[model samples]
Target: MASAPHSPLPVQLTTARPTVDGDHTGTHLGRAARRGELVRLHRGIYTDAERWSDAPPWERSTIATVAAAHRSPPPVFCRESALLLHGVSLLEPPRDVTVRTRRSPEAGVRRPAATFRRDVPPPHPLRHHEAPLPAGMSRPERRDALIRGDRGLEQTVLPPDAVPWCPGPEEGLRVEPLPLALLDTIPRMSRPAAVAALDSVARGSRLVDGPVGEEDLLAWDGFLRTKKARRRWESCWAFADADAESVGESVSRVLMDQWGLEPPQLQVRFVVDVDGGSRVRVDFHWPERGIVGEFDGLAKYQKPELLAGRRPEDVVVEEKLREDALRRLGLRVVRWVWADLRHPTRLRDMLLAVGVPFRG
Candidate 1:
């Protein structure tokens, strides 16, 4: 999957003539959308279809968030939306563009009041309409502002009693503070995703030499106003490890735990005899089992900095030699990729096949 671009492409509003070629009148814009030449991100908002198609889910969410922010009284982004703005890694793209509002849910309101426009099919179904709306919003006010196209985009307003805010990574965008965002976010995430987000924050803050420290947890714990929230926070925090070098590693660790496999030491280093006794760090190491596990994210082979002037094939060969050296040291090496994570049973079988021991 492609990493997010340094900057998002410009969004176009139908109220003004778009800078691109061809007639940019409202009718023409609608025609362009029907022809799949343009993608509608929100009502009156548009971007190039090709670019939108090429963007990964997280980037797409970011683009949609930007589109929504173009409106007046910009929403204070939170949850996954805030995480994306904060540059935190997520296991999956969020289901909607989430914002925070101080408005309370109506006494009788049990379901979301947002309505959808089905004139154009979205790239994927967005469940923004499923999120509850604040009390006092009229039927029209509850209606989503986005014109569904290729992929639907909708904003979910979280009606907490008091919504806090901070400056977003991008100027003019308001977001929840990182701790508050994580507290709101992790509870709703799957174990792998929750750990990935926490690991990311721990890595970024560098507040401690290892996993998030007691002080950090206490600071975050203070933000919890409810026992339920505190329990959720503690549950996710238990899996966090700062040593997880990447999202893949973080996710792999969480899955291993969930599968009841023996936990592996992360980023274990060895002074191999190869290449003048160079030191190499492996992703996961089980000392008792003599096993090394690697999560092969495409970034290692595709990112320019990671390649470091070496071709992808050369990197593969180097990895093979590294594995050979580890084998010589009587260690069994096992590897998995992004796809394997999606199939838990397959990953579990792979580990078992390689004699990865389960927890006692």
Candidate 2:
């Protein structure tokens, strides 16, 4: 007789659970409650030791997801769980799972110190993603089984004013994303932080045009609840003597403002009736000082009919063409790379040497 096909190795914990069907259960254990081929996790949870490696890292979190889905006392997956489900790059490393029960919070002490929460998700615009799974795999499986529940969470995007709380230095919690992870990690970031994050994105070969909708900015603007409205509106689209605004431009402005330097006029246009009637948009300009602070982000130098498919040297020439245009206008450009802002003090000094006064 042929043997039954074996389950994929549980890269995390061994389990009888089928990889996709989500089922694995034992009817009863005889007196003395003996078991076999055990792989212990925290407690009460175990992996069928036979096949452990096939499971991936996410599998470990599977226990939380399953427990969350089938709580006898329903749980809301709030706080850290809520943040995790929402894909917030910054979140607390989860320990004891939390839940809000429709019934009552689980009585008796659970080994992992479970916490009770109100059974509901927070408000909206903070989007949540719900996923369904098979029943039998709910609680019996270990971390490997945790991977079964799709990120079952519903959340509104965090409110802009929520000041993202994440792991920090000297703290032993699990770190979430690297200091600079996803390009949009700063979607709801505070102004100062957004400045830092945008600088990180700008340095990479990655920025695309800003997402057209102003919903996130609009939300943040309303929620700031301080004199920041003026600063935000001003910084939202900072003028560099005569340049249009992008996050890079805004960040450039913030650096100047925070450091007490002269802010440039934004999107100030200078027109010349060229041979074929061509028009142009510049990034930032300081007319009196004949200076322009240009952010050479991907857009300015990576267009398709231009550098996108060309050799990198060709890309350098494309940048030179733009620099030449500003030079023709008698503007002295102060170019800031992503590194300049990492040390704001030095950046302020650099500008000061070129005639701006930074009180710093």
Candidate 3:
């Protein structure tokens, strides 16, 4: 007389297809679907709506791309989709999905949500006889490989001097190489965001250590045909600093650069005699102006790893002590958080109020 045990939450949409067979009954899935517990991502794929809603836009895009890749003739993850797979940051995730296919580019399949492009052979797909992979390949290339070894895709020849990506052992999805992904991504981003993305890759975060250098990017820029794209991008690239410690810092630097503010020395160290000659590192310092800037990401206190076994209040107290020490040294401290970064006008005003001059 007991009701059937409720169906367990399905696996992440990227890994499994929700269907009404093979341990997944129509009755159970249908019940969940009707109850608003499951949302259909693509044909045959269903994921928890709550989880999908909570995931970052990039993660959601990835799930959708993986689901669409499972179609009869899978599409090559290209353009934005390819960039998502490469873990590159975007200004904003696109609502309209893009995929490349060899299926004659059907207009019928083109919908408000999805766009399919016809994969054509490049006029001159790069082939370096001496290079193991390609001219700008950071790693080796696989001639015929499955994305995650499950989904099948038709490999398209890359354009002349195109960069190629190699697969990682555990990365769940196949993606274009870092350089190619950047090439596709830069044009789509705003000037500042594009610089942020480029800075992120060049700096080599824990997630991705891009192999492309500034000079390499310059060479690649010559291959792009978009109007004024290379000129503007070069400016951003030139402004990019691998020294930025976080995305917030990187973006803030861009804003400062755009406003024509004098560049502050990054990650400067000061030996404060307070608390027995303790040394401290400041995010941005202008010795001539006697100003120090701090980008206060809450993670410093909230994240257990960053806290390093110290209590949140303890970290706050330590920061206060550090600030007081800096003040004693005749330096003015200006602090900003994520919210301040969003209201850049207000931020600029605050900095100007603190006597941080901008170049006219």
Candidate 4:
């Protein structure tokens, strides 16, 4: 499998003299911010306003992580932050930008006793946080940390004897190793999110060269730290399918399981005798029920690679004709979109309406 192309890191500027973008004084930065030409990501850290506005939530979070690295001593990114740096797919953007530090919590600073847990409900889609700055830092530094923390940056102490992190996508930054990051993150994700992330990890991403085999996943089991975390890892890994080609399909599978629907085969292919015996792969299939499931993500129509230079209307027509061919094969087809996934009961009702049976 070829690696996906990586997006260029957003251009960032700082108050430091002779910075990456250029030398800029505090006064100049302040003026830019006031003029709405630059968006402040952290104290003294700014990026082009247009780029900030154009980035997706996940990319925006990644940009913020880069901003955090500008502090006196950067933190080692972990959990979703590390996954984002690794180019792994996330079901939703992180609620907070998490980093691991060797610094101890200073006096009066409170930290979550357990930052990662499976039982807690997933965070709302929008990002928010209230992380406090560590005590003992300079006043300006403390204020900078506090401001970013309010915008969802968190710092956790690194565990004793922790594994070393790998070099990050950017210079001078480090992230937890992919396997360790997966173990630390997946246990805390919602079931669907966890499975989707694991599927992406197993299938590989930009930073990862190829599929992460079962051996690699098992290798990290010893790092799981606790019995509960181990169990959560097991439960999640059991449902992870590398055949899930996209986050949408992965989430749909989890929804099927949650609604007590029988498991369906993923990426099932059918040989159509059209266009010289072309093979068509469906997102999901239940041969026992003669049903095919498609998760209709807008990317299919919007992404240039998927569109293959064809117009959106043409893609829609091709999809309709493909559905007709499947119908000709006597397969009941069901389709749902991101909206259906957001409304928990909507997808379940759609599948049930199509006679997708519950698990016995």
Model 1: how far residue 153 lies from native, Å: 22
| Residue 78, model 3, lDDT | 59
TM-score of each: 0.72, 0.40, 0.70, 0.75
lDDT of 4 by residue, 36-112 (tens): 67765555566666766666555565566655555445556677777776668788766566765432342222222
- Every candidate's lDDT: 0.64, 0.39, 0.57, 0.66
lDDT of 3 at 219: 40
Better of 1 and 4 by lDDT: 4
Clashes of each: 4, 41, 1, 0
Per-residue lDDT tens digits for candidate 2, residues 36-74, read 343333223334333322332333233333323332223
Q: 15-46 in candidate 3: lDDT tens per residue? A: 24346555645356555655666655554455
Model 1 lDDT per residue over 62-134, tens place: 6666555544456666677777666677777665776654333421212222222343325322222222222
Q: Is candidate 1 or candidate 2 better by TM-score?
A: 1
Model 3: weakest 10-residue lDDT segment is 121-130
Best by TM-score: 4
Model 1 lDDT on a 0 to 1 scale: 0.64
Candidate 2: segments with Cα more than 4 A from true spot: 1-190, 194-246, 269-279, 298-306, 357-360
> Candidate 4: where is the Cα deviation over 4 Å?
1-15, 18-24, 106-172, 207-210, 217-222
How does residue 186 of candidate 3 score in lDDT? 74
lDDT accuracy of residue 241 in candidate 2 = 21
Per-prediction CA RMSD (Å):
9.1, 16.5, 11.3, 10.2
Show the lowest summed lDDT stretch of 10 residues, model 2: 120-129
**Best first by TM-score, ranked:** 4, 1, 3, 2
